[model samples]
Target: MANNSLLEIKRSLEPHVGAKVLLRANGGRRKTIERTGVLEETYPSVFIVKLDQEQHAFKRVSYSYADILTESVEVTVCNDEGQVRIEYLQQ
Candidate 1:
């Protein structure tokens, strides 16, 4: 995408900075950024997501806007303490 387009998309996504977001990888599976907010970074122009809790299964990850195509996303929460669960919701 072009810089102007990215900027526009970034501006539209600004409100979601402090909001929860679901990241979908190349596979069909998805990951959730818990309790944290969104952050903009320069190196790759992606969203920096912080982890609210210590995710035993996965670490904190940054999500690129390009990777997240839709507002509707799936959230997965799992840990050694409990069972793994999944949720699908709209952003």
Candidate 2:
């Protein structure tokens, strides 16, 4: 499933809490910032990621599902089995 709608996207990510994920977010001027973290929590409007201390300056970041819908941020879940990289689309 592409997880197009915001509710669908949230539902899709709900099971992956506490898993490792790589986030690529646009920082402006074509800059893409990468961060690896644990999937902390998911709420009605946004989801939180706890950043790895070794690689990032800030501790944790929260992003809205809308960001995913707009393609401003990308999330890739890393697991022992494999990586789950799904592209989200807006309904």
Candidate 3:
């Protein structure tokens, strides 16, 4: 049952590689971090986001589909004009 949902989540994101995305994630200890990046790649268990150079020191971050399912992270995909497409796991 759990595996099916993970597969569903992965399928939802596959078409959006290379799109712009806004990410909100729990930083632990009651902190939240937000970032804008291009959706770099998606794999069976994880997806990577390449951060905008001005806002973060790290070049990239990866999150598992379970993180979204559990609501610990949020991903909002955007169009070229920067409008919101879909939001999930909005922590």
Candidate 4:
């Protein structure tokens, strides 16, 4: 089990979805993929995700490269009206 709380992970990954993500493909290839969406369909692992420019959704298994890629994720949770600030990240 991961030491981090699910809420924390969920909160961190929320706003970052549909944002650009750097993916390390097979054979050391690196490409940028825009995160289409996130789905916590199952617990403990498996956050459903859809890729930008694609329709099919994929299950991004937790703790894998997919998850690690979000390690650098930056999210900003704002209040209604898009004026009042709520939360955000610097790194």
Clashes (backbone N, CA, C under 3 Å), per candidate, total 1, 0, 0, 0
**In model 2, what is the error at residue 11, expressed in angstroms?**
0.5
Query: lDDT for each of the candidates?
Result: 0.44, 0.89, 0.86, 0.37
Q: For candidate 1, lDDT tens digit of each residue in 1-91? A: 4555545555555544454443434443465433432233323366566554544343456655444444333233333455222321233
RMSD of 4: 7.3
TM-score of every model? 0.43, 0.90, 0.87, 0.33
Q: What is the lDDT of candidate 2?
A: 0.89
What C-alpha root-mean-square deviation, in Å, does candidate 2 show against the real structure?
2.9
Better of 1 and 3 by lDDT: 3
**Which one wins on lDDT?**
2
Q: Per-residue lDDT tens digits of candidate 3, residues 40-72?
A: 999999999999999899999999999888878
Which residue pairs clash in candidate 1? 17-38
Better of 3 and 4 by TM-score: 3
Candidates ranked, most accurate by TM-score first: 2, 3, 1, 4
- lDDT, candidate 2, residue 52? 98
For model 1 the local lDDT of residue 88 reads 19
Tally clashes: model 2. Answer: 0
Q: After aligning candidate 2 to the native by TM-score, how far in Å is the CA of 4 from where it should be?
A: 7.9
| Cα lDDT tens digits for candidate 2, 1-91 | 3334888889888999999999999999989999999999999999999999998899999999888888898999999999998467533
For 4-38, candidate 4 gives per-residue lDDT tens digits of 44445555555544443333223224643334333
Q: Pick the candidate with the highest TM-score.
A: 2
